[model samples]
Every structure is written in C-alpha cells, then in structure tokens.
Target: MELDHLLRDAVRRLADAGIPSPRADAELLASWVLGLSRGELALKALTGLEVSGADAERISDLVAERCRRVPLQHLTGSAPFRSLELRVGPGVFIPRPETESVVEAVLGQLRRLGEEGIRRPRIVDLGTGSGAIAAAVAAEFPAAEVHAVELSAEAVAWARMNFEVLPDHAAQVTLHHGDLRRSPELLGELSGTFDVVVSNPPYIPADMVPTEVEVREHDPQMALYGGGEGGLELPFAVVAAAEELLRPGGWFIMEHAELQAGPIAEHCAAQPLLESVHTHRDLTGRDRATSAVLARAQRGDVAKWRA
Candidate 1:
C-alpha cells in the first residue's frame, strides 16, 4: 500500500479507538517503522511511495497497540522535554510538555542569579523521574551543577539510561537513588546550598482517577499519586525538601495539577522560609506550577531550619 493510504487507514483505526491526535500518531508510527523523519514521511506520502509489505505490517501492529490506549511515547520509547529527548517506558513516567514551563521558571531564576554574579549555581531536581529537568538544565547551562533524586529503583534505572546516552548534556547531572525528602542525608553536604530546587512530583489525588487510559493504566502509581486524599502531601514534602536544600534566597519551583494552583500557592505563602509565592501557567494558560523564593535566613534561622 502507498504510504499516504496506509497512514489514512491507521489514523481511522486510532481515531475509532478514541486515540487523540490520530493523524499525528499515525504519522509518527509510520515514521518509526520507515526510519524516516516526519518530513521524509510526508515527502514519501506526497510522491506516492509504496510501503513494503513487512514495514506496512509493522505499522499496522503498532497502530493496534496505540489503539489499545498504549501511550505513544511508550510505543516510541522516547519523550521530548525541552531540549532533551528522554528514554521512557512502562516503569517511568513520561515527561509532559507542561513541565517544560516548570523548567523555564527554574531557568529564569538561574539566569537572574547569574546576573547577580552567581556563576555556578547549585541545582537539584526532586523526584526527577526520567531526569528530564536536570538533564535539560545541565545541557542548556553548562556552568550550573545539576543533581537528580529518584525514589523508585525502576525509575532510577530509566533515568540512568537517559543520563548515559546524553553524556555531554547530562555530564553534570548526578543521579541519586533515594527519596527527595532525605536530601540532608543523601546530598548531606549540599543541604541549604542549592541555588534552585525544582520538581514535577505526582500531584494526582488518590481518588481523582485520570480520564485518559494511557495515564490511568500505564503510568506508575508511585509517579502519579501525591499522597493523602487530596494528593498534596508529596508536593508539600517537596516544599520541605526544597527548604532544606535551597540556600537563603534560592528559588523553588514545582509542577502540580491545575486545580492545585491556589492551594499550593497558599501553602507556599504560609511557609516561614518561603516568599514571593506565585503560580505559573503553562502554554495552555492553565495553572501548572508554583514558585517561591526561600526567605533569606538570618544567622539563627539557618541553624533552626537545618535542625
């Protein structure tokens, strides 16, 4: 069958199965089978290029899996976040575009710190998942020291794969297999010294079942739930970890569900060590992240916070 015709059939199958962005997914799967870029696929389709039977069969099988609600990224085994393409699979949470804005917030603060003459800012990503945020920061700002902590061994393995493949970009990213809350222990010497701390912790309420099948079934629960009935416990824990890790006046940013914006902002505002509490919206203009600056600690305050 011709490439365009095969793609049309795949799109219909995916759409009938309720897969969003059917045409795009079909094209991407086709490109994967043909080992061609989307542009090249388009050119092939435009010129009436015929797909070999073996390759067309492969595309059909992939489309079937996608139609069964398998995540597109899982099928492709990769997800793009900011400037980094991360390896993603069943054990790892796929990085979403919204989290890119969370990275942007961190980068903005890092840039300002550079302007203020802090050349080598210490940065950490709590619950780093695929190490997307840490790798992106290290890739973009070579001077910054980046660290990532993951609680799940499975997630850590996947993160390590990404770190290894992107050696130049992830060279500065130190991956720690431990809970973010134990920064004082896992990253003991760096406690109260990070210039920026960021995370995309699980914020989905336990009872709030995700509407999409891909998320509802495939993503790891440990990377989806934030604990407690409202799912804010882990996010708040991220806040406490940031307080422990960040230097006085350092920045902390985190991603959460859209409905979490107000509560998270309020939570940050109430913290004695955090100020400049604000909510940042993603490209869709929905509240996606919250940011705050650690209140500069006085001599006694630092000791107390550390304790």
Candidate 2:
C-alpha cells in the first residue's frame, strides 16, 4: 500500500478506536517508524508511500498499540520536556506537558534569584520521578548541584537511566532512593545547604486514581496516589523536608493539582521558616506550582537522617 494511504488508514483506525488526536498520533508514530522528523516525513511523503518489509510490519504493530490506548511516549520510550528528551517506560511517571510549566516556573524563580547575585546554587528535587525536573534544572544551571530523590526502586532505576542520557553536568546529578515523607540519610549530608528545593510529588486524590485510565493502567500507583483524603500529605512532608534542606533565603518550589493552590499557600504560610509563599499558573493559567522563600531557621531543627 502507498505510505500516505497507510498512514491515513492508521489514523482512521486510531480515531475509530477513540484515540484523541489520532492524526497527530499517526504522524508521530509514522515518524518514529521511519526514523524521521515530522518535517522530514512531509518532505518525503512521496518516498514514504513505498514503505515495505520490516518497516511496514513495525509500523503496523505500533499503530495497533496506539489503537489500544497505550501512551505514545510509552511506545516511543521517550517524552520531550523543556527542550530535553527524557527516557520514559513502564514503572515511571511519564513527563507531561503540564509539568513543563512547573520546570519553567522553577527556572524563572532561579533567574530572578540570579539577578540578585545568587550564583552556583544548590538544588534538590523530591520525588523526582524520572528525574525530569532535576535533569532539566541541572542542564539549565550547569554550575548548580542537583540532587533527585525517589522512593520507588523502579522509579529510581528509571531516573538513573534518564540521568545517564543527559549531558555531562546532568550526569553529575545525584539520584537517591528514599521516601519524601521520611527523611533520607543523604539529605542529612547537605542539611540547610540547598538554594532551591523542587518537587512534583504525587498529589492525585486516592479516590480519583481509578478513574483515569491512562494513570490507573499505566502509571505506578505510588507515584500518583496521595493517600486517603489526598489533602497534601506528600506535599506537606516535602515542604517540611525543604524547610530543613534549604539554606537561609533559599527557595522551595512544588507542583500540585490546580485546585491545591489555596491549601498549599496556607500550608506555607503556617511555616514560620518560610515566607513569600506564592502560587504560579501553568500555560493554561491554572494554578499548578507553588514556591516560597525561606525566611528564618528554627532552633533544635535537627536534620533527621534515614537509611
């Protein structure tokens, strides 16, 4: 069959199967199959019409999987985030476009700090997932030391894989296997030393987990569920951890559910050691990330260590 015809048929199949953005998905899958960019696909459409042999078979299989609602990133084994191509697979949270805003917000905050003479800052990413935020930050601030922590062994392993693909500075990014609710021994080594602490911890309410097919079927529950009530348990723990981890005047940034802005701001307000609590919106103008500037240190705030 002609390549254009085959591609159109694939798109139609996906649409009939209830896949959103079928044409785009088909184009992306085709490009992946042909090892070409979308622009290249357009340029060589006439040539692509002749796809045969193993290439044809591979394209057909990938299309079938897409029709089944498997995420395209899972099929491609990569997801782009903030100019970086992150390796993603089973057992790791797929990087979402919405999360890109979280990274941008952090970068913006860091730039503002830089304007005030802050240089070569230290950063920590809690519940780092596939290390997307940590890697992106490390890449942007080459001189900054980036530490990423994940409680899931699968997530930690996946994060390490993604970290390896990063540039040299990102290769230097630290990955720790530990829980956010419980302090890690590694965090103790750099107590009160971080200039910025960022996290996109699990915030989805437990009751909502089973409702999202993409999340329930594909993503790990531990990376999505925030326990009963889903009312900022993990985010609060991360904030408390950041209070201990951040240096005086350091920053703490976190991405949460859009509806979480109010409670998160309230939580930060309650922390005597944190000030300047603020919420940032995503590209869609929905509040998605929160940040605060460290105000002062409390006495007897021993940085707890965990194995």
Candidate 3:
C-alpha cells in the first residue's frame, strides 16, 4: 500500500476510535516501525514510498492497540519529557507535558543557586515514578547532584532502567526505592542538605476517575491515586518531606491538580520555615504547581546545625 494512503487510513481509524491527535499518533507509530524520524517519514510519504509488507503489518498491529486505548507511549516504548525520552509501559506512569513546567521551576531555582556560588547543588525527586524529573535535571544541569525515590517497586524498576540507559549525565542519577513520605528517614544523612527538592506525586482524588481511556485503564493504580480527602494526603506528605530534605535557603516545588493551588499554597505559606510561597501556572495557564524557598538560616540556627 502507498504510505500516504496507509497513513490517511490509520488516521481515520484512530480518529474514529476517539483517539486524540490521530494524525500525529499515526505518523509516530509509522516512524517507530520504519526506524525513521517523524520528519523523515513525512518526507517519504510525500515521495510516494510504499509500505513494505512486514512493516505494514507491524504498523497495523500497533494501530489496533492504539484503537484499544493503549497509551501511545506504551506502544512506542518511550515518552518525551523536557530533553529526555523516558521508557514507560504498563507498570510506570507516563510523563505528561504539564509536568515539564514543574521541572522548569526546579531548573530555575538551580540557576539562581549557581549565581549565588552554589556550584554543585544537590536535588532529590520524591515519588520519581519513571525518573523523568530527576533525569531531566541531571541531563540539563549536569553540575547538580540528582536523586530519586519511588515507593512502588514496579515503578522503581522502570525508573532504574531509564536512569541506566540514559547518557552519562542522566546516569549520575541515584535511584532509591522508598515512599516519599518517609523521605527524611529514607534519605538519612542527606536530610537537611538538598538545594532543591521536587516532585510530581500522585494527587488524583479518590472519588475522581480519569476520563482518558489510556489513563483510566492502562496506568498503574499506585501511580495514580493519592488516597484521603481531595487526594492531598501524598501531596501534603511530599511538602513535609521537602521541608525535611531542603537545606536552609533551598527551594522546593511540586505539581498537582489545578484545584490544589489554593490549598497547597496556603499550606506552604503557613510554614514558618518556608517563604516566598507561590503558585505557578503551566503552559495551559492552569494552576499546575506550587513553589517556595526554605528560609535562610539565622545566626543561632546555623550554630545549632553545626552542633
């Protein structure tokens, strides 16, 4: 079959299946099968390339899975976040574009720390999931020390794989298997030492069910729900962990549902040890994250830590 015709047919099938961004997904699936970049595949489609029988069959199978509501990332075996492409599948939560803003918030604080002569900043990602935030920071700000903690053993396996396969910068990431709520204990002496602590913890409310077929059906439950009222339990615990892990004058940021902005910001602002509390909006302009700076140590506070 002509590549163009097959692509059009795939798009029609995917769109009819209620898949969002059908054309992009169709092109990406074909690119994966052909081992070509999407741009190169597009060029081939323009030149009347023919789909080889074997490759055509593979594309059809992948398209069938997509029609069944399998995540496109799971189909392709990778999801792009920031400058990194992370491995994701049945047991891991796929990184979403909205969470990139949370990474940016961390990077921004790291850059500020650099200006203040803190050259080798230490940072940790709580509930790292696929290690997307941790790996991105390591890859982008190579000078920063990166650490990640995941509670789910299944998700930790995927996080380990991604940290291992990435380049040397990302390979610097230290992956730990533990619950973020116990980060202070899990991190031990590293507690009270991080220059920035960040996370994209599971914050979906217990009563709320995601509407996307891919999310509702395919993503792991442990990576989805944050039990308790308003799903703030894990998020609140993460905030406490950030307080424990961050050094005086360090920064902290976390991603959550838009509706969480008020509660989270209020909670952070109320903390005597954290200041400059603020809520940040993602690309879509929704309240997507909250950030704050741990208060700088006082003369007496510094002496106490030394003791």
Candidate 4:
C-alpha cells in the first residue's frame, strides 16, 4: 500500500486499458494526490510512504474513470492551455497542445500589427469551447479586448467558469452564447468590430468521428464532427463572419484538420474579402492553422450589399 507501489499499479492498469502516456498520467495523478511537484514525487517515492485511506480511494476512483475512457483533464477538472490552467468538465472540450500554435499565430499577427503602431487590438474567438483561445489571448495581450462565442449552453457555462478563475486580464474577455453562423443578434453586436478573429472549430468529418476512441468516447461530439465531407464549414462560417466582424486590415486565423489545409485556403480565397490566405504547420510539421488579412474597404462593400 506504499505510494510507489500504488502508483506503479495505477500506471499498469492504465497501460493495460490502452491509455497513452500511462506512466506520465499516473505520475501526474500521484503528484496531485500527494500535493507535491513531480520532482518531489520522485524523491518521496524513494521513501516508501503510505497513502492515506481517503487519498487511496480518490486515486482509485480516478483510475476507474480513466479506464472507462473518461479524459484525465475531466477527472482532474482542469487542462493547461498556453500558460493558464483552465477548468474543464463533461461539457467542454479539453484544450490540446496542438491548438497552442493557433494562439501563437494570433499573437504573432498582433505583434506584427503592433509594429505598425496598432495596439490593444480587439479579438474574438468563435466556438470558444473551453475559452482556451480567448483566455490565452487576453493573458498575452493585456490591453486587448477579447470576446468568445460558444453555441452550447453547457460549453458556455464551462467557459464562464474558466473566465472566472483567470487573472485580472481575463476580465477583458466577454462570452456570448449563440451560433456564429445563425445568431443575428450576436452577429450584430460584433459587426465590423474585431481586429482579429480566431477559432479551433469542430472539423472532423461526421463519419470519421466514431473511429477516434479518445475523441468519440471522451470529447463532446458537437466539438468534433463538422459535417459530411468535412470541407471546413465551421471555419468557413468563421471566415464569412469575420468578413463582417473584422475591420479592414484585420486578420482571421483558424486551427483545422491538417489534411484540410488546401481546401481551407481555397475557401478563404473564395471569400474575396480575405487576402494572403496562408497555412501554418504545427510543431509536428502538419498543416494546422490558416490566416488571412481582411480586405479593409471591401468589408463595408460586402456588408452594405448583404444588408
């Protein structure tokens, strides 16, 4: 019943259950239970300390949930995004490391604009699942006005929880509940107002969703399956919305399925209001994010014609 033995057993069980990074996950759980850092856990492991009965029970329950395909982030109620640890749960999408590049791309674009004497840019995160992108943008650019939109009521609640726990800068983030493609009132509020628009929308083809155990079993389906053909409807909607939401010379960036980069670029090209459509690869060298500048004067032209 020693801590090291318990951790070893937990790791073995997780591995047997087909969980990736079993040892690392076990270590993280152990550290959380013991209220120690991972390095501290290593040192304490050598001492052969016994876990309290209550702590052992808690870890056992967590392990059982993991075996049931529940995400560790959900079990722990938190996920790390950029430098922030945001609360997560059943209704929210767990933030992934790959999406960090999306945040970086937004920040880089902001920095470039800053060099041109633009500061305190207004930014929006469409379909902001866990509010990861919005929160990160607020933290990185304290002066910016950040807003996030989510269609799911549960997701909006989870995002609001994350927003509450953030630092003072998080106060800058405004959360709206409604679909970007359909909510006219919500759309009107942001019409021609943002300097940057970013999103990590659901892009997995509807049929392909069932094949990924981690996604199908643990993540919310509404946050994953785009539609049939997976041709970038969500990202396209964000692009079209951005045409109305972003100021001329503003930028829109989106994280998408790596294989859909060409189609995403093509979609942006068709927008006519978006120029310089470009794809950015993730750390693993997969095309993961795309960005384009809004044609400034044309936004008004497009909006007026649509009106």
Provide the overall lDDT of each model, using Cα atoms, as 2-decimal numbers: 0.89, 0.82, 0.90, 0.84
Report lDDT (Cα) of residue 288, candidate 2.
Answer: 92
Clash totals for all candidate models: 0, 1, 0, 1
Q: List all candidate RMSDs to the true structure.
A: 1.5, 2.9, 2.3, 1.8
10 residues in a row with least lDDT, candidate 4? 206-215
The local lDDT score (0 to 100) that residue 250 gets in candidate 4 is: 84
Lowest summed-lDDT stretch of 10 residues in model 2? 298-307
Model 2 off-target regions past 4 Å? 46-48, 297-307
**TM match of model 3 to true structure:** 0.95
Which parts of model 3 have CA positions greater than 4 angstroms off?
169-171, 298-307
Candidate with the greatest lDDT versus the true structure: 3
TM-score of each: 0.96, 0.92, 0.95, 0.94
Cα TM-score of candidate 2: 0.92
**Model 1, span 1-307: residue lDDT tens:** 9999999999999999988799999999999889999999999999999999999999999999999999999999989888877899998899888888888878888899999999999999999888889888887888888899999999999988887766564557789999887877999888878999999999899899889999989999999999985899999999999988888888989999989998999999988888999888899999989899998877377778657
Worst 10 residues of 1 by lDDT: 164-173
lDDT string for model 2 (71-120, tens) is 88899999888878888888999988888887887787778878888876
On TM-score, the leading prediction is: 1
lDDT of candidate 4 over 51-169, digit per residue (tens): 89999888888888887778788877888899898998887788999999999989988888788888778888999998999999888888778888999999999898888876774
Descending-lDDT candidate ranking: 3, 1, 4, 2
Q: What global local distance difference test value does model 2 have?
A: 0.82
